[model samples]
Target: MRQPTLYLPHGAGPCFFMDWEPPDTWARHRAFLENLPATLPERPRALLVISAHWEAPQFTVQKHPAPPLVFDYSGFPPHTYQLTWPAPGAPLLAEQVAGLLQAAGLACGFDERRGFDHGVFVPLKLAFPEADIPCVQLSLRADLDPAAHLAAGKALMPLRDEGVLILGSGNSYHNMQVMLRAWQSGALTTHGLDFDAWLTETVTQADAVERERCLIAWSSAPGAREAAPREEHLIPLLVVAGAGGNAPGAKIFEDRVLGAVQSAFRFG
Candidate 1:
């Protein structure tokens, strides 16, 4: 069976492994990640993750045979740094990914040195705890162009049939400044909800052309700039949306975190 593409909310750095003041701040999101595999069609042969954490001049793929963890985040508990998922690297899949992009007329490159960043491991450590599946990490382009990333995803759609689970790891609402301000003020912010609602509607549209059109012009959506001052996190969704092709998207998960509404999406 073809695997579904996922756009998941990778919560604040190492949040799941630490104790929060509210104690249950990340509880629901953690549970969602832990239970994700059960919702999959089958065990994936490998995983292809497009993370917001890494961006290159061109789209890049991790080609390390045994990649290490990058420990990309800081200021977390010492135990969080010691955290390990130890999933093997999918070098062959990296090559396949590069080929797909090139064939689609998209620029592609390979990075043999870079390892899995927090964006790849933090959520996967909860979802695929066993760390048994081979995985490859892909980078978003530095340009953060939605249409280009979508095209890159469309090129890799064949991987789904080949048992490669394509995942886009990033939060739906990623404006730290806005989130921090709301959290400090002890007041709820509706910008996140406004953007999430528009995004959900755009992705779940029955008309693929309209969905793509809306996404391509996503900056115009309600609260778009407030929700995503920088587009890296939001860009991953476009790739997943593009890979979705004719299939309509579904909002699989949603939660209010740090005064912002974050969500996860799935497209078959």
Candidate 2:
């Protein structure tokens, strides 16, 4: 079987599913998630998630057999905090990821105490609530550099061959504070959409070398800097691309934000 890896934009907050009105773009993603399981070519033995929510000075792997909750977000409905995503943790797979990092000339360790951050739980609850398949999560390195995250993903590439579904979860258009500000200032530009469009084209058309080059110099892309201010959300997609290495990306979902923000795409 061919190995498949994905870089998916996982938005913030669980309230995404509850919003029903226009200007609320997450509805598309929610519907997309509902269709996620049946769309898979095969059921994976395990899932390895690289969530933007989990960050560390060095890479950290979640290793508990029964990982706990990480209520990483704040200031929402009280029930949102109590939302349970009780998925079994994959300590063995987490070790393999750590070992891969070390073999690739990187420092790494385990975090048996770590819990499931919102990025993992939100997507998992929608995609695989059965909690039967083994799951593990890796943290983003401190630098948040594109090349570094891509390289880190390449290190974990072997997992795909071992029946592990590697997923790099983050958003494509992630300047939350900026976009919110642009809306408040009533001075929004086409820069973010322009950047998102350029990104989709590069991802769908470019070769591995060209794609890597674009990612490394991402700040120069049409709306690169504007799309991702901190780049934490954007970098995970690079890792997914690095892991897949020129494989065709089939966008299983696409949605425009309030007729403005270009927020969508999925790969396998």
Candidate 3:
């Protein structure tokens, strides 16, 4: 009954809920996200989402039974702020997650006050609009170290066999500066494509040891900094990679958005 894990790109700030001027700007992403539930090997019992939008001094798990929406983004339509995806939180899974991390010597805590940020809610809204699944949120470490996050993912690996879905929600290429230019020109930059190609090759390596090595040293990849700039969005992939154990990953979706190559992966 082992469940597959996912690394997804939750598109920029409320894009799914709004209309872009080009009309087709978000079409590909929207279709890909909406198809997520069907793409799964099986329906998951609970989802443990690692969000890029949330960062804490240490790892934190959401414990609230009814998690609220955080609306972490701004400058979208007024209705966008009012959006809600009222998925109940999984407190039991939170305990399990904490135990796993603590057992691995990773300092972790629980939070009753946290809510689902865009990273969790946006994709969930499209993927599972019913909001019937019990979901929990895990915060990224504020320090944003690749190895630490990868280690954290390794710690949580047991949850997959326990029927908990591990989903790392972040963008593949998250450079805002280049995104704007691509949005205007309707063309992806070479830096973004180069980095994305490197990521694809790295993650899809048949050898798990080599895949892990490449991810741990991800910064050295061509155009890595130009594509990510800040590592927040990219770090989620490391978490997913570690949780994968010996499982290999494949690019489930790949497309151009705001002139950047966006991709998603599934591990088993």
Candidate 4:
């Protein structure tokens, strides 16, 4: 069976492993991640993850055979920095991914030294706690072009049938400035609702062509800018959406975090 492509919300920096004023702040999201593997068709042979954290001038793949963790986020609990997910790196898959992108006329490169950032480890630690799967991490292009990332994803569609689970790790709504203000003020803001609704509709559209078209023009959607001041956090979805091909997408999970609506999507 072909592995499904996913776009998941990787919550605020190691939030799942720490305590918050509201002790259960990350409980729902953590549960969602924990339950993710059971929902898959079968155990994946490898995982190809596109994270919001890393961006290169060109599309890049991590080639480190024994990859380490990157403590990308700051000011978290000291123990959070020491969290571990010792999954083996997929150097061969890195070459395969680069080949796929290059064949699609997309610029690609490799990094043998870079490690998995929080975007990859934080969530995967929950979903695949054993960390036994061979994993490859791909970088978003620094340009952050939606169509380009989508094309990169389309180029990678072959991996699905080969037992590689394609995952896009990002938050659906990622305007940190706004979210922080709302959190500090204890204000209940629904600004992300419109964009969340629009995004969910676009990705879940039965017509793949239409879905791609809407995603390319996503900046014009209601609350688009407010939901993503910087597109990095949302760009991974474009890749997952592209890899989806003709498969219909479904909203697998949804939650309100820090006054912003976050969601997870599965394309198959």
TM-score per candidate: 0.98, 0.90, 0.97, 0.98
Clash pairs, candidate 4, are none
Candidate 4: which stretches are off by over 4 Å?
A: none
Q: Which stretches of candidate 3 lie over 4 Å from their true place?
A: 185-191
lDDT of 2 by residue, 1-268 (tens): 4458877666666756454344455777777766776766688889888888878999888899998889888777787887887889988888889999899987888888998888888878888878788889898888887788878878887887788888878777777776556556666353367887787777776476776787778888886776777888877787777777656565556554423354444445
lDDT, residue 124, candidate 3? 88
Can you tell me which runs of candidate 1 are displaced by over 4 Å? none
Estimate candidate 4's alpha-carbon lDDT, on a 0 to 1 scale. Answer: 0.94
Error of 1 at 135 (Å): 0.4
lDDT by residue for model 1 (1-268), tens: 9999999999988999999867898999999999999999999999999999999999999999888898888888899989898999988899999999999999899999889999999999999999999999999999999899989989999999999999999999999987778777777654488889999999899999999999999999999998899999999999998888888999999999788999999999
Each model's total of backbone clashes: 0, 1, 0, 0
Candidate 3: pairs in clash: none
Candidate 1 to truth, TM: 0.98
Q: Which candidate is the best by lDDT?
A: 4
Error of 4 at 64 (Å): 0.1
Computed on alpha carbons, the lDDT of every model, listed in order, comes to 0.93, 0.75, 0.90, 0.94
What does candidate 3's lDDT look like per residue over 196-260, in tens digits? 89999999899998998999898899999998888999899989899988868999999786777
